[model samples]
Each structure stands twice: as C-alpha cells, then as structure tokens.
Target: MPEAPEADLAGFVRAHDPDRFLCTLFAPAAARPALFALTAFNHELARAREAASNPIAAQIRLQWWRDAVEEAAAGRPARRHEVATPLATAIGAGLLDPAALLAMIEAREAETEEDGLETEQDFVAWLRGTSGGWSAAAGRALGADPEAAEVLRALGAAYGLAGVLRSVPAHAARGRCLLPRDRLAATGLSAESVVATPHAPTVGALAAEMAAEGLEALRGARRDIPRGAVAAALPAVLAARDLMRLAAGREVPAPRGIGDRLAVTLAGLRGRV
Candidate 1:
C-alpha cells in the first residue's frame, strides 16, 4: 500500500516542493525515513532562496545556506539549522551525498544572483547545470548506474530547458528573461518587445518550439528510468512540463494555481502507477 504523506518528514518535504516530492517513488519503505528527512532538509535550505521576500534577505539567507552546506562538508555541524540534524542523520544512514547536497545549495546560490542570461546557449547551460544538476542528484539517490546517470542527466537537462521555455512569459513579466537575447534577436524580438507584447504569434511559436525540444529530450530519456516505484513518477514529470506549456500559452506571471495543478498531476501519477 502507498504510505501516508505524513509518514516521517514526507509532509515536510512536500512543503518545499509538492511537485518534486513525487520523485521519491523508488525509495524503499525502509529508506523513507532517511529519504524524507534528507529531502525535507534540502527543501528547507532551498526555501531560503525561493521564499526570500527581498533581494537583500534572499542573499543573506542563501549565504547562510551556503555556509551550512560548507560546514556540513567540513564535518562541522551547525545547531541553528533544523534541517541539518535530520540531514546529518540521513548522512549517517548512507542516505545522503554531501557533494550532491552542496551542489544543490550552489545552484540556489546562483539562482539568487541576477546573472544576465544573454543568449539561448547561456540559458540552456544554466538550466542544465542547475535544475538539471538536481536531476543528476536524484539519479544518484536511485542507485543509478553510469549509463542510467548519463540518461538521467540528459533528461534533467531537457526538463531544465523545458522549464525555462515554459517560464518565458512568467520570467518576462518579472523583468527576467530565461531565453537568450541572441535568439530573441534572431526572431526580431527584443527582450523589451517580449514583455510589452499583447501576445505575439511569433513569441508563442518560439515558446512552443522550445517546449517541443524539451519534450523530445524527455521522451528520449524515458526508457532510461527503471520500472517499479521509480517509474511511478514519470507521469508527474510529464504533467509538470505540460503545465509549463499551459502557463506559456497564458503568459501568466505565476504559472498555474497549485491546488488545481496538484489534483491533475497527482491523478495522472496515480493512474500511471
């Protein structure tokens, strides 16, 4: 039977990312406590960046997370970090990777900065290295073989690319652009034009084209995911991608509403399982 969401730190993990909590599928019940605890810890650290109410606070909190990550790597534990306790416990249980965990924190640090993404290539690289990096971590957690790891990394890159594509409208609304300025230039669309648009057909075409590429990459990696509990998560990935596609179409700032999205995503994942 499926375990309750509240089991261990599952609910806590979900609070950080309801969407990605599905990725824990293949973890054995014996490992759930450790896994949940690890995810909850990571999620909380991650929240420092995402939930930062302002840039200064975000940078400060992100710095703190970076410090905690560095401390954890040095085998020096900090008492102020609630997540670190469970994280250390999970590490003791062989349920954690210090490098991967640090990498995630590093990604958040990058996200906190306002680095300009001037071209499609630059944007792609950032997405692949950051969000895609997390996908690699997930693969490592799954006992992914080398070949499987490569496939998962590729899949992660694809998802990252897709995520950027889907968030184009949202990003533009926030005065951020994940798409490369060079690519937009080629289309005769400046970043300013993109945000000021009343919805241009060309923009939709660009978004759709990018989304398609991401979907293609995802499909190619589909076979790499093993069957069993891990496989149960495939649908959630696809559904989230689709939601991004929808958000692109609407050109909305915040993407889709969480409750409705969760219902559709959970139902799809359950059906697939």
Candidate 2:
C-alpha cells in the first residue's frame, strides 16, 4: 500500500533533510506531521530550479507552487502533488504561513539568472530569503510568537552561509561559485580560479574567513531564540558545527554521525545551540 500522508511526509523529510527531520522528532507528536509537511514543501521549492531542464521550465514549476500556495491560503483545495497535498493540509491547519512560503519561492527566481551573485548585498539577500525565511516559518509552526520567530530568521541565514562555505569545492567543481564577485575579488579569488584550483590554500582561507563571519552571526542570533522555540531552531547547532569545520578549512560539512546526533539532542534538551 502507498504510504499514508503522515508516513510519507516523515519519510520524505527524513530523506531530504535529516537535520530538520531529526529536530522534528523532538517536537510534540501532534506537531510532527505539519512540521514534516513544512520541511517537504521547502525542499520542493528549493529543487524547483535545478530539477527543471531549462529556465522556463523552472519558472513554470515555481509558478505552479505559487498558485498552489495561494489556493491553500484561500481555503481552496490545492493542486494534487505530493508536497502540495501535505503542505495544504498544514496551511489549512494554520501551522504554516503561505506568505512566507511564497516569499521563499520568489527568492528562488534569482537562481535561474545566468549571472550569479554580483554584490555582497545580493548574496546576503539570497541567504535571508531562502534559509532565513524557511526558519522563520518553521519557528512559528513550533508555537513561537511572531517576534521570536522573526529573530530566529538570522539563524537560518547563518546556516545558509555555512552551507556555501562548506560546499566551496563542490560548487567550484561545477564551474560556479555562490560567493559574490566582490567578496571573491576582495579575497583574491574568482570563480574561474576557484574552479581551477578548488583545494588551493587561498580557497581554504576564504572559506575560513566566511565561516567565521557566519559563526559570529549565528552566535548573535542564538542569544535571542526563545527557549520554547529552540527545538525548531536546532539546525543552528548543525550550522555551527559546519561553520567550525569550514573555519578550519574542512571542505565538506561533516555529516551527522552518532556524535552529531548527540550534540543536537543535547542542544534540544538544553534549548541552546
């Protein structure tokens, strides 16, 4: 038999976002499915561009999601896709906000542009819109008031920064880099040079610098996350771990192993990062 919606969402989230998935396990049982739905929805939005064959195709997929979110927000039945079905249920239950999800979809449109991030402002905006928005929505779903949820957005952006720092070599291998041109130039690096010598000392140095910046931002944000809402914000621990690795010139973010799981669990229990 096909999986039930709750089971399907659980499996989807566990497969696509193990960090959030593990954190979701710390949530109350009644909230798990909705949280899973939110994670799944974000995953779909994230893949909208890359999953498509062309720019136009990516736009079409994003548009479809926009409409689906609007329909769900309006109390109408959403389009019958796997992610949409569960997401609509969560939105209908008032556990997730359509506007936040819409903003995330809009942010992704930038990825389709041939020219990547040009300025530091653009890079910062992308991080805020993508990861920051996601955390805000997920935070609210876990019962945080709007004020606290908004503050938690910075944690998500920190995670985004760490992700970019950790994936330097992977992105360089693809002949692309997520760092803004100005930042790269400031560090005496370029997309071409990064691609040519991904493991060079300069690349590691730049990654370390960027990771340190992200760690500082993350620490500032964590100080304000409400205790009750910390479970939803547990990804900050993983972000910190990744940022520390990048700062030490570790190319790839360390995967969650036994120790990592313990760290998140302890952080969740303590309501600290």
Alpha carbon lDDT at 46, candidate 1: 48
Model 1 — TM-score against the truth? 0.71
Query: What lDDT score is found at residue 51 in candidate 1?
Result: 70
List pairs with backbone clashes in candidate 2.
Answer: none
Give the Cα-based TM-score of candidate 2 against the true structure.
0.92
Best by lDDT: 2
lDDT of 1 by residue, 1-273 (tens): 222334545766666655456556445556555556555655665456457765568778766656665666566754444466666655655556677676666655555556446767766666655656555555556566656655555656665665566666666766655566787888887777877762678888777766656665565555445543342234336444564554356442343467545554464455332
Candidate 2 lDDT trough over 10 residues, lowest sum: 248-257
For model 1, the run of ten residues with the poorest summed lDDT = 227-236
Off by over 4 Å in 2: 1-4, 252-254
